[model samples]
Target: MNALFKALSHPVRRSIIDMLRKGPMASGDIAAAFDMSWPTITGHLNALKEAGLVSPERDGASIRYRLEISAVEEALAFLLQMTGAGRKDPGDEP
Candidate 1:
């Protein structure tokens, strides 16, 4: 999907998703892993959320982010389709 590709276009966002894949993480914790400002990290997270690649929740004073693996799978499926993996069976050919 366009959104998934857009979200993954940045290396930072990919790394952020990798971090979250282990489990949900607080916004601060995710930001701390990088040498960037909190607001900058927040923006990246927002992009990921917009792409449906991640989900966020408010916990106390921090927002926790989690990876949406299904979105990643959808992207992968799109890629596979491009490679002809999604074609119908030979018996079903027109």
Candidate 2:
């Protein structure tokens, strides 16, 4: 989707997604991993959330962000289609 591509256009947002790949993490923890201010990191997180790439859930007192793998898979499939990487040849046998 357009939103997903836009969100992934930023390196900071991409890093955030990579971090989330291991598992859900608190916003504070994610922010700490970056050199930028908390507010700046929050902006990236917001972009990712808007794109449906990440989801936030209240974990006790803090909010934890979890990666939505389906979004990433959708993007991967799109790219593969563009490159004809996974498509079967018309003449190929089953």
Candidate 3:
């Protein structure tokens, strides 16, 4: 989980995740969205991949990244548990 948070710590990485929300995208297209050098964007993608927030599949000559919804759901579930947002009502207990 620490890795997930660490990967999300960077704005660039968050943006990349947001981009993937629409659908899988080529690595080159992702890099085109940012002004930084290719290596920098690649590093961010690697971090996201390490965190299990994204998956990369070879698409012919390029790689396409897809968002891993399960990882995001896990993070959201953790936050919900911490905040008691979805807890069952004690008064309703049998």
Candidate 4:
């Protein structure tokens, strides 16, 4: 969970996930959206991967990344906890 929060803490990473919500994208396409170099974007992708926030599948020579929505849900669950709702789980909403 710590890894997930850390991965999402960055604006670029959040933006990447937001863009991916539209659909899966090639790493190059995602990298192109930022002014940073490809390697920097890749580092963000790696962090997201470590948190299970994103998963990449190989298609021929290109790698397409898909967002794991459940990770976002987990983050929301954490927020709910921080809000002092006293709910142990996100699904326990009254």
How much is the lDDT of residue 36 in candidate 3?
100
lDDT of 1 at 73: 93
Q: Which segments of model 1 are wrong by more than 4 Å? A: 86-94
Report the poorest 10 consecutive residues by lDDT, candidate 4: 84-93
Local distance difference test scores for all models: 0.93, 0.96, 0.97, 0.92
Give model 1's TM-score versus the native structure: 0.88
- Global Cα lDDT for candidate 1: 0.93
Candidate 2 TM-score versus the reference = 0.96
- Candidate 3 local lDDT, 1-94, one digit each (tens): 9999999999999999999999999999999999999999999999999999999999999999999999999999999999999898979766
Ranked by lDDT from best down, the candidates are 3, 2, 1, 4
The TM-scores of all predictions, comma-separated, are: 0.88, 0.96, 0.96, 0.86
Stretch of 10 with least lDDT, candidate 2: 34-43
Best by TM-score: 2
lDDT of 1 by residue, 1-71 (tens): 78789999999999999998799999989988999987899899999999999999999987899899999
Candidate 3 TM-score over all chains jointly = 0.96
The CA-based lDDT of model 2 is what? 0.96
- Compute the lDDT of residue 40 as modeled in candidate 1: 95
lDDT of 2 by residue, 1-94 (tens): 9999999999999999999999999999999999998889889999999999999999999999999999999999999999999899999899
Candidate 2 Cα deviation (angstroms), residue 49: 0.4
**Candidate 2, residue 5: lDDT:** 100
Error of 4 at 92 (Å): 13
